[model samples]
Target: MYDYAVIGGGIVGLAAAIAVGKRYPTARIVVLEKEQTWASHQTGNNSGVIHSGIYYKPGSYKAQFCREGNRSMVEFCQQHNIAHEVCGKVIVATEQHELPILENLYQRGLANGLKVNQLSAQQVKEIEPHVQCLAGLRVPSTGIVDYKQVCQKYVEIFQAQAGELRLNTQVQKITSRSDYTVLETNNGTFETRFVINCAGLHSDRIARLTKANPEAKIVPFRGEYYELKPEKRYLVNSLIYPVPNPAFPFLGVHFTRMIDGTVHAGPNAVLSFKREGYHKTDFNLRDLTEVMTYSGFWKLAAKHASEGLQEMVRSYSKTAFVRSLQRLIPEVTEADVIPTHAGVRAQALRPDGQLVDDFLLVSSQNALHVCNAPSPAATSSLEIGKAIASKIPEQSLLASSDCCLVTTNS
Candidate 1:
């Protein structure tokens, strides 16, 4: 019998399991992953940008965790000798009409307690000589790191603490007993005192296994990206993001200079047919049906119809994508970039068609389910893990400590 079972071997899952180990050193904690490898999904395919929490709303989990995570993640990389860069990023306004909105973003960054600087077009050029913008907001704390490496270190730490990790162990069902939870998996059946569901794309389904209905459903949005060709890499020195459309949930197309010296650009958000689908043609009938049948998805589609259509057009046409990238860097052309890998984001949408904007944790009987964690999740992972671990009930399971603090209503 294990004290804790963590599903999913992604970065968040590993970090969470590690945190639990630190909290209860004598407890038997196991990390269960469906895939043989770690962080092969969201963590591996992420843009590798460490967010500064400037875009999130003040007093929200994303804001607080992201701000703290930026520092902790950097510290972890530094201590472990991981490859990372604290290269600052600039949010630029290309058109004259976007200047006021840029100012609002600057103010929002300040509200979030970030040391941001409002920049004139000339000042923006001083930082990124190849870019053209009417105004800019420089975020100094933004950085990049390979989360897979970070997960590797987390695995080392957990294993050193005598934690167990079972790869290729996909959870099939969950049964809650009076004292412990029974988890039926492909590998074997296991009984544990508690379960932590960190199954990124499949988190909601895992929650349902315990007979808990998470108010929101996971909808996969594929973020398509392109890398600047070897010859054109010099155009981007660091990250350059456009002022995101407040009406849209996604942070629009942007340029990023990765840690390896190659620059990546244009992660246009488009609906993915499969939760694990990375390519345009990749499809899964069940996944498509769930999305098509979801009223919330249809409502969200209707709400962002225009932007959605544009994203679809750009997905099919390289010229259109290049044109979108040209907004941030006018010099980028069709020949300047090559198609790169894509990462699907599991965004949670409520039945009322409203998107869950914060990191959602739902506490069920003997289980804590991470229902919604997207975008900055990779950046806010360490803090998120600590938060989840801190809320776990004591090993003895007292009458007063029954359920964890569920952030979102179930």
Candidate 2:
């Protein structure tokens, strides 16, 4: 039996595996992925922003992990010679009404110990020539890098330590005994002393397989994006963000100049019929049925009906999307952008219609589950890995914690 078996091959899974391998050098560990390649889903499909800790609640996992991760991720990139840029980003407020929200965000950044500066309209123009905003916050610590490459490095590190990785191995069932856990898969069956479930989109299902009742269900919300055509790339010199609505988890449409100098726009959040639905037409009957029947989803839908309708409108109409973009940079037009890609976020929803705001971890005596990790997760991967490694029980020393984060000092 392997000492540890980590499910899912996303960036977080790979990072967690590497940390575990390092912590117990002699332990036999296996990283399993249903897909043939690593980071094929969320990690590869992101905009590559190295998020600052500014957006998260103070003392929460997202804040601490992101702040620490920003440093460690940059160090890793430098040491590994990964292509990256520490280009700063500006969170802009276009209308007078958003000024108060911007101030609150600035204060939140200060509370998180971030080096963020409030900027006047003219000062914002000095940084982003084409942008127009009533006020702005310049976050010099935010950066960008290709996370897929970082996942590659994690795979290498873990494998170098004699860790085994099995591709195309889909876990079909889990039988957790008092002594050990058995992961039955399409390829074969494997027994391990412990399991780490980092299966992003399917995490809830995976938890259920292990007979753990996760309070929240995973619901997929597709983030649709577009890239500015080559000639129009000048509109964005760095990252530009709109002040996010506090009631919602999604940051509004904004511009980001990637490390390679391509500018990506938008990512309006819309509900997807399928868990892995990257296109408008992609659908799965079961995925659709589960979400439609979920009381939490319907509650959330009813609460955000108006904003939800707008997101759906923007998802379909290029004109609606361009209007949102034009709010930040008035020069943007329908001709400037071309549809690029879409990523589905596996958000966890409570029956009360509240989204899990922080990193939610649930554990049994022999297994740990990372149920709801999205957005800044890529940025927080390394620190999160470190924390999980330090916590993975030696011979089930860990106890049962249900539907709550297994807190560790990061």
User: Whole-model Cα lDDT per candidate?
Assistant: 0.89, 0.91
What TM-score should be assigned to candidate 2? 0.97
Report the lDDT tens digits of candidate 2 across residue range 189-220.
99999999999999989988987766889999
Clashing residue pairs in candidate 2 (N, C-alpha, C atoms within 3 angstroms): none
Off by over 4 Å in 1: 395-410
User: For candidate 1, which ten residues in a row score worst on lDDT?
Assistant: 396-405
Q: How many backbone clashes does candidate 1 have?
A: 0
TM-scores for every candidate against the unseen true structure: 0.97, 0.97
Candidate 2 runs further than 4 Å off: 399-410
